[model samples]
Target: MKLSELGEIGFLKKIEASLPLSDKSVLLGIGDDAAAVRVSRGKTLLSTTDLLTEGIHFDLKYISFYQLGAKALLVNISDIAAMGGIPRYALIVIAVPDNIKVAELNELYRGIKKTASSYKVSIIGGDTSGSKNSLTINITLLGEAKQGNIVSRGGARPGDKIFVTGTLGDSSAGLELLKKGKRSGYLIQRHLLPAPRVKEGVFLSKNRLAASMIDVSDGLATDLNHICEQSKVGAIIYEDKIPLSKELKKAKLKKSPLNYALSGGEDYELLFTVKASYIKKVYNAISKGRLSATMIGEITEMKKGMLIVDGKGQKMPLLPTGFNHFR
Candidate 1:
């Protein structure tokens, strides 16, 4: 049952038999040297890739192969969502270790395939290789959007309001619980399977509701700094405005949940900016329960610098403390 016994070619043949081509956009799928895809006229292509390595990005002891596979593809889907695109195709390359069983790899592929299909994505092609000790999954996702419907991190301007979808810090809180040997908690599930806000991002972009947007993968502070750095603008956010989940709020921890909201990574929520004139429309949607988001701050002039106003109205510099692979 080991992958070594089946070998790469045999394993690939098994995978090919399991996946049927359903999307017309994918001219070719698995078993091809490279995938051939079709792009609609007047549409822009959005491509994003992510790499997850065992021990560095995840610990297999705490996660199943199925969960790991789903998370790997979902994170890449989040990137396409941030760009306001509809996911269409994927290239999944994995490095398998000798200790892994063929059944485990099948479960992993099932996870990726299920998540991909849910988002209307086709698994086009990928390469498999042998690894000494670690399992690595690298996914390249391809998406499409109308030329004018794409959002970027650099479109934010001064005086624009900052907003984020859903609650924050739940994933990090879930991670904390996992470290303590706790399982089956709500917080733990949030950490394991974070959802991408593709509908929200697309709606905002198509409606021109958001001036700029980015997913909160590297924590709010760091990802917001990405927008700031890209747009060459400064911002001021209120501490009390940062949204927190009830589950995260109830969890007892060494540090405040607010701290996790600020710098804890992998929330996969969308953080965006809306111009002042469009603020009313956004609030209207929020009031109608059509949109789930909170206005946290406003963009400021670059010279003003990034700052956070405390509950007492005290101002201080906002720093990026999110997860950095090298740091």
Candidate 2:
């Protein structure tokens, strides 16, 4: 009835019952330090990990166990997608609170299963343990990409156009609405389920269009600076060019929409760079989908530093306003 009675093993048994492990390559699932898998020749492996804590990363009062589980894994998949890779496997390490119900744990695993299945990835192995005060989920995802197809944060060149997939500020808008006890269908959905742009990443990698790429886990301003710092370049972003979502427009938080779009985190959209010459091709490819890529800025020489131009056409130094552990 209660979690303390069922214990970790019992909870794991219930969760494992529904896992359909059809892939023969998955030699082990849900019971080890790591999942062992056979890799095909000539493909490079991409590995990423993310940790979610109860009070820090989420508030259980507003988030469902299923959503918590789904989000824990999907966010790591987003990292692989940013590198232009296909996710193949995952290992989940969960810290459970003694008071959490066995039924709740099962619901969490169901969400994890749904997310992994949606991405065609297998949960090969994991570990479970008891924590004193809160629940924590740590997930490591492994993926593969062609040797030369992998994108990184250090490849941007001066004159390349900066583009982002989909409109921004929706997740932050959703958070704002949630905090105010107001409901906007789009914002709520955006917060609950943020889509990773895997197909778009693959398209960019295949076309050789993305010189550098990073996902908008931190706000656009912070993530873009990551590319600039790594590439040893500077950037100039135009305030008017950044795409703001319809939900953000409707929410109309006291802060300007541009501020939310630029500084609010958890958007999960892709931020990428393309040479000016290939912009047309990139635009054409994304046009086929409902999602539109907006070009908001350009890479510049290192001496220029990162700058943002306001509506008055006055340029100002851009500060990192995105998520930082220390700040």
Candidate 3:
């Protein structure tokens, strides 16, 4: 059935069916203005907000409202994770049109609650208002880290090694698949539900392995450029060293996956740097059986700018080409 026919409540019921609540601190889930939680001492608070609009951030034709709600919260949690913090609470504000049904609103909240519970975060409070045409969701996540343990985007030193959590370009590849009307399983899932590396981020921060970190909500090239700009350093990413999903490889063989991986946005993985001394320690903390951390790059002097070495060993200038609000 078309989304318009489902109204809003009908859509919400569908989403509510899929949620599994495991957290005990969530006094109210999917039915309240906010979520509540308890926290311990010696922790500094971390907060971040992400705003998503109907046409600007997503297309209703391809994305489901349930997924939209989950993604909205997930992206903000990713920002908190980028700072090496544990998400504890969220405040969600939604602006909806008159055509929206009460059920659809419930479904969206279901998505938010499900994601928040998974991260063990509570939804605290927010505001709901009427809008003209677009459905807008603004999520503010509250997280915590030990005192002075928060990682930032500006701490990468000259000799630090650049590392990334999880594979890159999958989201972009997934978007390409949707645009092409292809139904590849991997790409579709990647696009619909990109997991934020919160556990890994907390581990890195607790162990004091990461010098600085940022999530690749934007493309790697653009996000890494952000690190460079903030840290006053340059970086060198090895082209062949970039990790690609099998789905991405297939897409590349058929088209240009590198361009999408490098310039496309919404990867949700953490891009972090560690001092040369902590490289092994950080790797040891994040390494799983197969998904090992690869040394894809290094921080360089500010005068060098960002560079990418092609497989043929040629140095090429790196341009910051990713999602921009005003571009």
RMSD vs true structure, all candidates: 10.1, 10.3, 11.1
TM-score winner: 1
Enumerate residue pairs that collide in model 1: none
Best by lDDT: 1
Return the candidate ranking by TM-score, descending: 1, 2, 3
Clash tally, candidates in order? 0, 2, 10
Give all candidates' CA lDDT scores.
Answer: 0.86, 0.82, 0.79
**Residue 69 in model 1: shift from native, Å?**
0.8
Ranking 1 against 2 by TM-score, winner: 1
Determine which window of 10 residues in candidate 3 has minimal summed lDDT. Answer: 27-36
Model 2, stretches more than 4 Å misplaced? 1-41
Q: Against the true structure, what is each candidate's TM-score?
A: 0.87, 0.86, 0.84
Which pairs clash in model 2? 29-124, 30-125
lDDT winner, 1 or 3 = 1
lDDT, model 3: 0.79
What is model 3's C-alpha RMSD?
11.1
Question: Can you give the lDDT of residue 70 in candidate 1?
Answer: 94
* Residues 257-313 of candidate 1: C-alpha lDDT, one tens digit per residue: 989998998999999999999999999989998789999999999988889999999
